[model samples]
Target: MNHDGHAKNSRTAYTHLLWWFLFAQGGVIAAILVPIHVLVQGILGPLGIVRVVDRHYDTWIRIVGNPIVKLYLLVLIAVPFFHFAHRLRYLLVDLGVPAARSVPAQVIFYGGAVVITAVTIWVLLTTVPISFG
Candidate 1:
């Protein structure tokens, strides 16, 4: 619509959309899951106030060894990585790093999150048993 009757292809718009989507989903997932994890695993169980049944070490191992539990743990641990990355990326940008849509910044931050997520998956699958069978 400028003069050649064409729309400008915004390179960063779709990329930003993806990051924003991850940021929002990560925020929601973390908010819902993290507090529950902290309360059950850290506060309530340790205090002996709620008496978490799987609080024992063996039981904890058995519980986490379940496939569903592994998936849940993966989601819990991985999604938050993106949330933190997005937050940190924006924090730097907000602090005047001129990285509002910098590709390097996005690559670094998002790449860290991806690496951490892959490590988490590998560790879970290799170290944590699926079942004694």
Candidate 2:
């Protein structure tokens, strides 16, 4: 039916739009972070202020502790998890998984991603000490 075709088209379009938006956002974040990250590492390396081995742990703590950084991290985690889950669902469906099984698999994948995101946010919020308070 024409109506069914149109509805399916619309849903596909919307899903594509969502994927593009997330990809754009992730790309922008990467663009901004990559330069700053490189600059910081370069500066530290020359001054011998931080070695490569030490930098890994130090950078992790510093970023996780900052509120803005933590917010970006949360976004990064959530968007990628959902995006991958959606892609995985499509793959499973394409590989001949029944619609019934695929639907539940998709649901479980999304649910797990949500749970992991919540746990990550909670851990970051509680463990990081706020300097302003």
Candidate 3:
């Protein structure tokens, strides 16, 4: 019975570790890339510092047609989304939300990330192909 208990404990600990690991990865990617994305596209382009004059619909269509660009966009959207989920989860927990500290809370928050990821993958797979041909 004791050995069985130990095994269960180890598995639970491993699951928690996996959640934290994903959160850390998301955080790191968000910190590194999000600012650069915002600066270039949001700030510089709008301010005319980068001169995004040709950034019309057709230009974006061709850009998204490239599989590599699609993958990059997937990473850009998905990772930061997970980062937001992770941060929101902890923030709610810290703010003394009773439900936030529970297993269901983890599921609710991280499950949201999973759902977003699935939608992103689906859209990319279906739309990118259709957009190309």
| Predicted model with the maximum TM-score | 3
Ranking by lDDT: 1, 3, 2
The lDDT values for all models are 0.82, 0.65, 0.75
What would the per-residue lDDT of candidate 1 be over residues 1-133, giving only the tens digit for each residue? 1355335553346766876787788899999889987988789988989977567777778877889888988988988888899888888888988865598888999999999999999988997689852
Which pairs clash (backbone N, Cα, C closer than 3 Å) in model 2?
none
* Overall local distance difference test of candidate 3: 0.75
- C-alpha positional error of residue 87 in candidate 1 after TM-score superposition, expressed in Å: 1.3
Model 2 scores worst on lDDT over the 10 consecutive residues at 51-60
lDDT of 2 by residue, 19-55 (tens): 5676566556555555755666677665787665335
Error of 3 at 54 (Å): 7.9
* Model 3 worst lDDT run, 10 consecutive residues: 124-133
Off by over 4 Å in 1: 1-17, 99-101
Q: What are the per-residue Cα lDDT tens digits for candidate 3 across 101-129?
A: 68898788888998988898888777645
TM-score of each model, paired residue for residue: 0.77, 0.55, 0.78
Best candidate, lDDT-wise? 1
